[model samples]
Target: MFKVVICDDERIIREGLKQIIPWGDYHFNTIYTAKDGVEALSLIQQHQPELVITDIRMPRKNGVDLLNDIAHLDCNVIILSSYDDFEYMKAGIQHHVLDYLLKPVDHAQLKLF
Candidate 1:
């Protein structure tokens, strides 16, 4: 089973994702959630999830910094952001992020991965 970690500053977003995703159908069993990048990092270290979906602009660490810190780890990353500009997208691409989703996340889009 694939393990997944989801991190976002907004409580609603985090809860929404947890409720919406049909994790078991996608071979994902363990799901972890956090409110900030710092907390996410701690969960990542402990869980070593196969995938990490995190918000780009979050308190304490941000998605980019967390990705950089875990660059050597064997985990795929999905970045979530309200910004759809080239700069953030470029950075995510450069870092080889698995995917990026804009705010007000689309369940269909997320399930594509």
Candidate 2:
């Protein structure tokens, strides 16, 4: 079993994802949620989850910065953002992110990952 972390500034989004996703089905033993990149980074450093789903724009720290900080960690990333900016996409690519997902996420698309 693996662990996964979900990072977003919105409470509804964080909680909604936690409830909607079938973590057990995906072989995830634990799921952690963070309201911002600051908390997410701390969780990542401590727990070292196998997967991280993060938002691009966040308070305290942004996703791109978090990506840079966690580059040395052995974890896959899937960027989640409300913005469709190419710069953000480029950053994700540079960071070797597994995928870049948009806001109001599609459950089917997310499940495929």
Candidate 3:
């Protein structure tokens, strides 16, 4: 079974994202969430989920920092951010992030994953 972890600072976005995906349909048995990068890193280490979707900016650690730590892992990475800055994309690129989603993420867009 595949596992997934989503990291974001906003409670609503976290909850909404959790609800948006039909994990069972995607063959995902476990879904986890973290409010900030600190907690996110801990979850990633503990669960080692196959997929990680993380926000670009958060209190503590930040996505770039987490990306640095997890870059060697086999899991797929997706970045979420409000910014369209090239530097953010560059950092994600350095870490092999597979996709980027703007805030207020569209469920359809995510479904494609």
Candidate 4:
């Protein structure tokens, strides 16, 4: 089964995602969470999940930094952000992020991704 990692600074958002995501529908079983990019990178190195869903504006190493650091890793990435700035989108695109979801992501849409 595939493994996934979810990273966000906000406890509520992170918990909500963990509870809401339809893990059964996807070919993944293991789901992990990290508070920030620092923790995320550590988790990535250890678990090497297939997918990573991360918030952009997190404390202690943002999503972009994590993405850059993990460029050599073989995995898909989805960015979650409250800001809809083109620059952030552009950065995600540059790193070949699988998708960029705005805050309050739709459950249906997230399942599809």
Candidate 5:
């Protein structure tokens, strides 16, 4: 079993993902949620979850900064973005993210990742 952390500034997004995803089906045993990148980073450093799903435009520390910060960690990241910007996509590529899902994230798409 693995651990996963879901990070987003919005309460609905954080809670929705946590509840909607059938994490156990994907072999995830522990699930954690964070309100922003700052808290997410702390949780990442502490728990070292196998996976992280984070929003791009968060306060405190944006997804780009978080990606850079976790570049050395041995965890897979899936970015959640509301915008279809190339700059963000470029960053995700540079950091070797597992996948990037635009918001109103598609559950079927997420499962494929």
Candidate 6:
């Protein structure tokens, strides 16, 4: 089963995702959630999850910075952003992020994994 780590500053978004995703159905067993990138990094180091889903504008080490810090690490990153901007998308692409999703995440799109 795949392990996944999810990070977002907003408690609601993080909680919503945890509640919404049917991880077992997607062959994922472990799901870790963090409120910020700093906390998320610790979990990432310990869990080394197969995938990471994070909000781009989080406080204290945003998603892009976290992605850069882990650029050499072997993990798939899926960035979630509220706005559609080239800067964020460009950075995500440069870091070889697996995918980017906008706010109010679409279940259909996520299921396509």
Q: Measured by TM-score, how close is model 3 to the native structure?
A: 0.94
Q: After superposition, which runs of candidate 5 have C-alpha atoms over 4 Å from their true positions?
A: none
Q: List candidate 1 stretches off by more than 4 Å.
A: 111-113
Better of 2 and 6 by lDDT: 2
lDDT of 4 by residue, 34-99 (tens): 999999999999999999999999899999899999999998999998989898899899999989
After superposition, the stretches of candidate 6 with alpha carbons farther than 4 Å from their true spots are 111-113
TM-score, candidate 5, is 0.96
Q: What does candidate 2's lDDT look like per residue over 3-113, in tens digits? A: 999999999888888888888888988999999999999999999999999999999999999999999999999998999999999999999999898988865668425
Per-prediction TM-score to the true structure, in the order listed = 0.93, 0.95, 0.94, 0.95, 0.96, 0.94
What would the TM-score be for candidate 6 when compared with the true structure? 0.94
- For model 6, how does the per-residue alpha-carbon lDDT over 1-113 read when each residue is reduced to its tens digit? 89989899999888888888778888888889999999999999998989999999988999988998888888889998896889999999999888889988866667325
For model 6, the local distance difference test gives 0.87
Report the C-alpha lDDT of model 1 over 4-108, residue by residue, as the tens digit: 898999989888888898888888988899999899999999999999999988889988888888888998888888989787788789888888889877777
- Pitting candidate 5 against candidate 6, the one with the higher TM-score is 5
Write the residue-wise lDDT of candidate 5 on 9-44 in tens digits: 999999998888888889998999998899999999
The ten-residue window of minimal lDDT in model 3 covers 104-113
Q: Model 1: how far is 77 from its true place, Å? A: 0.8
Local accuracy by lDDT, each model = 0.87, 0.91, 0.86, 0.90, 0.91, 0.87
Clashing pairs in 4: none
Report clash pairs, candidate 2.
Answer: none
lDDT: the better of candidates 3 and 5 = 5
RMSD, each candidate, Å?
1.2, 1.1, 1.2, 1.1, 1.1, 1.2
